[model samples]
Target: MTTERQFQHDSQGPLRRIVSSVFSIFETRLELIGIELSEEKERLIGVLFLGLAAMMLTMMALITLTVLIAIAFWGTYRWQSLAAITAVYVLVAIVCALRARAGLSNAPNVFESTLAEFKKDRDTFN
Candidate 1:
């Protein structure tokens, strides 16, 4: 009876340790995931503000330049200048769309590090 009890205790001890270790590893991964999410959020917010600012400034400059160009050619090549500006804008729009598509395709996957860590853990366990 004592030997059976001792064997049971020994068995429970290693099993408990294994469970605890697994949980600890999972907890660590969860914390890393949280940190990655936070960093991603901050990055996106910063990008949003910066992008908005740049877009606003660019629009203001374009508007001012367009008005100036139109006014200068008002009595001469008014229609021609307008057409030229429209053509330029169309071409720019096309280029910007292409570049944006390329950028999206090339951008790194979000939560890359977390996914990598999970893969490493899986490999380690395996």
Candidate 2:
């Protein structure tokens, strides 16, 4: 009767409310993480595919141009032409490698949003 109702009400008091709020927070954070993960996956796949295609086409062009240059200079400066091409390729490759290394260091954190959200929640609770 009255005591039973009080018991039920007390059971659903601040502690229960706090637990429910925490669970809701966790649910929201989990949903955000899942959405971010999907977006990251899509972005990574697109970059990978596009990079591979570009590399393949550029390689073909390079081979064709190299052969054409060698053939054009066959009589006189053939060896010098090949040597110049080799040196230029080495320099370009070095520059590309350095730029890629720089890019890796500057790459954005994948979980930055998640961590930011978590920090916001913490600040709010504090």
Candidate 3:
């Protein structure tokens, strides 16, 4: 009976250790994910603010330039000037849309480090 109890205890010790180690790895991975998420959130917010400011400034400049052109050519080329401005604006919009689409398509994968860590762990286990 004593030997049997000893054997059970010895088996449980390693099993417990393995469970504990697994939990530790999980905790570490979760913490890493949290950190990456927080960083991404901060970066996104910063980009949002900067992008808003840039858009506002660009809109103001475009409006001012259009008004100036219309006023300067009001005597003879008023309609032509406006039409040309409209065409330019349309071209700019299409180009910007295409560029933005391309940029998004080429963006790096999010949580790259976390994925890499997971792959490393899997490879090590295998």
Candidate 4:
């Protein structure tokens, strides 16, 4: 009975080793994939920051130019000049709206693509 038990234990040794090896391979692969995902997320955040900075700079420049123009034109015309100034402001607003729409349209659709890729990876692993 002791000899039979020894045979049974010996038979399980290789099976256990194989299972452990398979698990180790899977774990290593998961680690590598996690590293890749983290790098990608960092890159995306950098891009978002750059876009935000550019937008802020553009708005600041626009504001500065508008103020300079208003100051330069102040008191240069009749009382009806206020109406003209109001019209100019309206036009600027419309132009700004169009530019905002264009910028939004051009923005990268990275979120959807990233989500889809992650879902695909998740399904593959599952």
The segments of candidate 2 whose C-alpha lies over 4 angstroms from its true place after superposition are 1-12
In candidate 1, position 4 carries an lDDT of: 100
Best by lDDT: 3
Model 3: residues with Cα > 4 Å off, grouped in runs: none
Better of 1 and 3 by TM-score: 3
Q: Write model 2 residue lDDT over 92-125, tens digit each, in one string.
A: 9899999999999999998889899899999989
Q: What are the clashing pairs of model 2? A: none
Candidate number achieving the greatest TM-score relative to the actual structure: 3
Give per-residue lDDT, candidate 1, residue 30.
Answer: 92
Question: For residues 1-126, what per-residue lDDT tens digits would candidate 1 score against the true structure?
Answer: 999999999999999999999999889989998998899999999999999999899989988999999999999999999999989989998999999899989999887888898899899989
What local distance difference test score does each model get?
0.93, 0.94, 0.95, 0.75
Better of 2 and 3 by TM-score: 3
Per residue, candidate 3 scores C-alpha lDDT tens digits across 28-109 of 9999999999999999999999999999999999999999999999999999999999999999999999999999999998
